[model samples]
Target: MVDEFLKWYFSQRPVLASQLGADGHDHTLGDFSAAGLTAREREEECWLDRLSRTETPTLDDAIDRDLVLSHLRGSIAMQSWPEWRRDPSAYLGPVFASMFNPFQQRLKPEPELVAAAISRLAEVPAVLAACRANLDPDLAAPLLVQRGLGQARTGRNFLTRTVPSMVEDPDLRARLAAAAEPAAAAFDDLVTFLEGFTCGGTWRMGEKLYSTLLRERELLGYGAAELHEKGRAAWAELDARMREVALRVNGTQDWRAAMETLMDDHPPTLEDMRAEYEAETLRARDFVRERELVTFPEGEECQVLPSAEYARPILAVAHYLAPPPLSSSRTGVFFVPYTPDGFTPEQVRQRLRTNCRAQMPSIAVHEAYPGHHWHLSYLAAGSRTARKVFRTPYFTEGWALYVEKMLHEQGYFDTPATELAHLDCRIFRAARIVVDTALHCEDMSIEQAEEFMATRASLSPGTAQGEVNRYCAWPTQAPSYLTGAIEIERIKESFTGTPREFHDRIAGSGGLPLGLAEQAALA
Candidate 1:
């Protein structure tokens, strides 16, 4: 049915016709062949290439208008819904992505746009410098020129360029401007949001579009209190079980010491880390193929790559590949950081310990098993273009969260101490859920949120507060980690029969939405 609709839509829309102007500003498919086509060419070609492979039978104008309008309506409806009673801190995530992910701000010549943006080789350095400086009027402050990103001149300039493209119609403009007031007012409530980094640049003020964004990022329509409660209950259970296992593994010794001893017994050298990763990737591939766990189409293969700079920070422990363009054959990359400061000789040597060895297997499962790495690979294999192009954060983060603790029972983290670390992460994520709810809707202070995380999760004060700051700046995201995990857990437990059958049940079908994860497991 969808394919039939798509075919009809394609004929009506004639995306190619829309691109060409009536004045016959001739866009020669081959005329400027040597100089290469412009930016418009690249975008058109990218879309065309994707469409050509769709296997849709026909193209109709009604379908074209419907597709474009449907997407646009989804956007405008979020902003204009009256008495929507939505949260303010959750708005405009995709809007944020469009602004930050690449360059689209300025009127660059067609050929240089996306490439210029991705390289970050444009005047971004100057912009970063300016944003970090002690300027007279901060970008966070309300002003006529506050239409872009931060201090980075190029970043801000690019944001300005990109935003207009998403929202340009005059009627929609008047409605957006009118609806924006409440959201902007909500921003004033999140004071720490403005005092972002030590360098004086402001974080993205996406909290202004909080309501719609929250709905979009989170798959369900649940309230904050419900999410907070679910996370807290799950954390409590995981913590109790972890400590019990820790004591047993140490033969009644203290939990912390047991952890240290275990890590020392199974530590890996720096070189071993690389070899082990390659070994695991192959092992995972074999398991999927043998079990038929979501088939990867013939000729499709997943690859691993070294981490990049912007990604390196968050993925200090683990990372994965960025989506390649349609024409590219680059497989997904799984990256592990090798920072000398972080991975000292002593630290690397610790992996030789037995307990540490036990830990590596669980980490492997979290990174490569039925976890995100495999889930995404499955998605790509099934060719779910809409889900691929637009994935909800709840689903993405939830799948990863589910995989983290689930590895414990999978025979990966056998010893108790290593298991403690897994539980600790779960605890930290749980605290984030509470903090995410209280921080925004309940209007908790930074110190209060930090205190809650530190006490409940056993996190250092610095780590807790850093998390708090992230919540203040990012909003609603803190819950995604644990929220996703718990939902996955619920789905797993809801199964009526053996866990093996559960595994086989989900083997063929690709990733499912959180709302249906439980139902799918039962089916």
Candidate 2:
């Protein structure tokens, strides 16, 4: 039953299939039209019914069944919101991925990959037309529309310029270029649609649905109000810690001032900044091995690269993109953002300041090394399809955040500024939980959230705006980082084993929710 469901699921999500190195579906963009979604929902219901009735003979079988059930339930519950009907951004993700996965994952020969990309590109107009047909601008949130426009614009740039340059063979390049023109035009049409929208919809998910998602979908022990309170407490605790580290760094309790002082010592240019991050990635990997912090799977590798031009708007600083689990390559890309083409001088300064030297060590540890790349590598090697495909964001995001603090305690962060930077990051995540809940459940406006982030998290105004825009679009995701770390720490407190054993146990659990992962770890 599980196998049947997964096959159907992957069949309907070709973009996902491509990303996971699954072939045979790369030439198509899965259905997004109204009739298509209705058909999908009907099929989903059928699968859920069959899976619920199926019998499992062993403990492992039962666990797998439960995982599939959880994933199905979450998908059904979220269907109530009808994201495709309201958010234009909903369509952009798969649109971007359709080309991105085929281009990046070298699973096939270059010509074949380019052929797949061209096919997907040809489908772009139809996909955008479906987006227009399904989306009700009256139900769209203004901020969501605005951000979707930004993404559309950059996506157009990526297809026209970056994608063609990536092709080496002249024949394939010509084919890709021809296909890209219509695809780029599709993005422009999307941009026009979004710009014309006077979206009046509320971004709020409301207290009831938000709480339900926190408890049911996220598999969390607490609801929105409790999570918000926890976030406030965590923020306060981290803020106090930051002040102490700040005093050590600059002889003052003004943590923001200390952060400014550290920012002044950043790399001279974006290229230099990328070099610094590369060095830190290698350095942290070595430190982890020397300290026996966690186990590394054989042949694991991570490469630091500039952020893709299309993703820089949302990827304000740096992030990790895990390698395809089904691919032979174990290399993950760590993307560092560069200043965009039209950024004002001040905007460029903010972009550079956010990636400054003092923060690089902690960022490197969180996004690469024993954080995301290292943890995900273990799962890629050994996890079942159920675990690999169905992820709990808190566990994934939290584990990354957890390693930052864990390594700090292990003396990996040798400088006071680095420690200060780690604490500031913690505070930032904590603030995310607070701001996220406030925006979705407590009726905080976008402007207020941006202000809160800029002042409390010590983010630049532009960075704060981008962060808030993300929070608006993705309801519970922002809170996952800090909340996940907090949950993992709680789980650690109950373990009697060495740190490495505990870390390895949790890392090996794939993307299970914290509650399930804790049971697996402590059992």
Which one wins on TM-score? Answer: 2
lDDT of 1: 0.45
Runs of candidate 2 with Cα error greater than 4 angstroms are none
List the candidates' TM-scores in order.
0.56, 0.97
lDDT of 2 by residue, 464-516 (tens): 99899888888898999988988899999999988889988877877777777
lDDT of the structure predicted as candidate 2: 0.83
Tens-digit lDDT track of model 1 for 279-354: 7667655654565534353444444443333222222355554333222232445565443233455434532332
TM-score between model 1 and native: 0.56
- How many steric overlaps does candidate 1 have? 38
